[model samples]
Target: MTITVILGAQWGDEGKGKLVDGQCQEAQLCARAAGGNNAGHLVRVNGVSYSFHLLPSGLINPTCLNFIGSGVVFHVPSFFSELAELEAKGLSAVHDRILVSDRVNVLLDLHVAVDGLEERELGDAAIGTTRRGIGPCYQTSRARTGIKMTDVFYPDLFEQKVRRLADGYQKRFGELFEYDIEAELARFNEYRETLPKYVVDGVSFMRSAQESNANIVIEGANALMLDADYGSYPFVTSSSTTLAGIIGGLTLNPKNITETVGVVKAYTTRVGAGAFKTEDTEEIGTKLQEIGREWGTSTRRRRRCGWLDLVVVKYSNSINYYTSLNLTKLDVLDTFETIKIAIAYTIGGEELDSYPADLNILNQAEVVYHEMPGWQKPTTNARTYDDLPKEARDYVEYIEKFVGVKIKYIGTGPDRDAMIQRP
Candidate 1:
């Protein structure tokens, strides 16, 4: 059972889409293990760029079977829209190879409404949600009142579930925000009817495939730093965004995993608000952002750019048990006069090599940086690591040494062929 897991190691927006698509070429099955439409994976193939939400990166490859595992919260509109876009691109046959987990929860229109309302109410205390109803949907799932894709197959059950959730939310809305629930439910039912057709039982299907020795690639959303449990606390996502999430999300054993590849950008970039140890405020940071196009795929919000934080990378490496690393966007730093990498963190006068569990400590921590000369020569034309300038190679080596992981793949450009495989 050669199962490979690919995920971001930063606060997301780490170019996971390209890495997963590249890896999917070698695997038979590629599965999206977590997150909802709130997470977006952008892939540039043959000069055309495709932005996907609620679809596995593998969908671009017609030969691979893509599975949406139980870990995700389904958003029908976004899923169908993405599918249609892919179809418009002449990849309509992809639907035949994709499957969704029956156990995955569905994100209803009301959930989106309620989530947005709640975030607005929170004001400054809000966790900087995408307002895509991801948090609310997961909350409902844990509350044992969520609607699954299977529920859509049964009209009576689906209606009953919707009514129950709507009734409860309506009462809370009045008490919490003085909003009318009856009107919201009426509108939600109308929207629900327009949802796409989906079958459940993804866990069983994946398990059977595993028994048959199918090569499965578990694609993860977000990154370790955005995980609800271990990430920058209160600012993290609603779900577990780590490799451990796959065990519960897919009901799979850790023993069945063959390899896990953690994807990290050459530098770091994060969306929303959180503790960014290596965040750059100077001209160099702006250059990286522009060159890398560091922006959120779901919200199109400009990302907060920063230098490489080895402290967080090492933390992710330990938690995800990453066997290999796919370092992307290496060419983004080619034109800079110098590149700075955060080697460690100094918290309360003590130099720490690892991330602190306490957000307070993290917020106050000072980064110990190491500056390396940037390569003036262009790397966009370099197809291999050997072809890259010496300074660029040094920067890569610095990251590999500090993070304690081998750089297996380096992305020089946005194109699929722009990736360089390290020897």
Candidate 2:
């Protein structure tokens, strides 16, 4: 594939890392479009487990060059921390292989401090952010007061900008915002010598990739339902986490995208606070969580579990336009006696036109579900489509039919290569 975007079809945590890692073997360029270290993609390679936060999952493929695009809100300290971890895990020659966008916004530790304070101010109405400075950093970015990637190299400009940002936050939060700007600048002074080596102009970088006809893989962080514009308002992540993000984040042309592959779990899950119409707070929900080990990779918080909601996925597809689907974590549902898929939503005995944006309306919406027979047999051993039991095949076929997209790849296990690809 020339250009493929692997996106989470629901509310993130869809095992995108393993999928991107597998695809990276054939890819020359792997780029992260949106979000920040708040998004995590875990990939296990040859018994070594890697958790990618700020970095691209493609680093595991030594031959695949990586790009952290302009649309990202990057924190330098987190970047080095993650990079050092990956290096210790035996991924060598990493420094020469990855590039950062010069136009990318910098996420400060001060911003991270502000993030928690803002959430505290909201009290019970908080958006349940990861407190990694994602929201605050993006806020500074849009307001045009944030530090750019290239600013770190200029001492005066970087210091002036950081002080201005710190002053603004200090005024907003008073003594509650206790950040050492001098220390932050000093840390940046340490980063300046090293970071410039990896910086690149995003437009020119993608232009070169296009000229080479590189097999580019765009790894989407977060998910469509958590998008800034389309997702649940105020509760959503900072950047656009859908197909629209891929273009803005990468500074790439839409025509360059050859395939938009949506990664969906056999069941659905979401993190933080939101009105989940199909949210199962009962035994089935607990079972899905415990069996699936549904904890977030970034925040380490237990994800809110529920049955697969096609209403959510279909709404996501309408925005991202997935060419095919990757039904992941099928084996997680192996022990369940029956599996359910939410087909539609209704409240007051009337069907709604689409996924209503109003959280109040969503809270009152009744999820209309369709149940299916579970394949008690484990799918972990299946190497081919026929290897799966008929029940499992039926489950896959039904999802493919319902979603209006072929399930081109089905993940049977947690390993990076434990996937069946349909040609």
Leading candidate by lDDT: 2
Q: Give candidate 2 regions above 4 Å deviation.
A: none
lDDT of 1 by residue, 1-423 (tens): 688888788888888888788878877888888889988888988878898888888888888888888989988777777888899987758767778887889887778888888887888888788988999999999898898777776767877887788778877776553444466456446645654435547767877878886778888898999998988888889999988997777777788888788899888888877778787778867888888888788899988888888888999998988888888888888778878888889977799757988877888888888888888889984787889989888888877877788888888888988888876
What lDDT would each prediction earn against the true structure?
0.82, 0.90
- Candidate 2: Cα lDDT at 272: 95
TM-score between candidate 2 and the true structure? 0.98
- Tens digits of per-residue lDDT for model 2, 1-423: 389899999889999888899999999999999899999999987788999998999999989999999999999888888888889988988888989999999999998999999999999999999999999999999999988998888899999998888888888889999898888888888899889889998889988897786899999999998999999787899999989888888977788789999999888899999777778898999999999899989989999998999998888888999999999999998988888899988999898878998878888888888999888988894789998988999989988888799999999888877899988
Tell me, what's the RMSD of every candidate? 2.5, 1.0
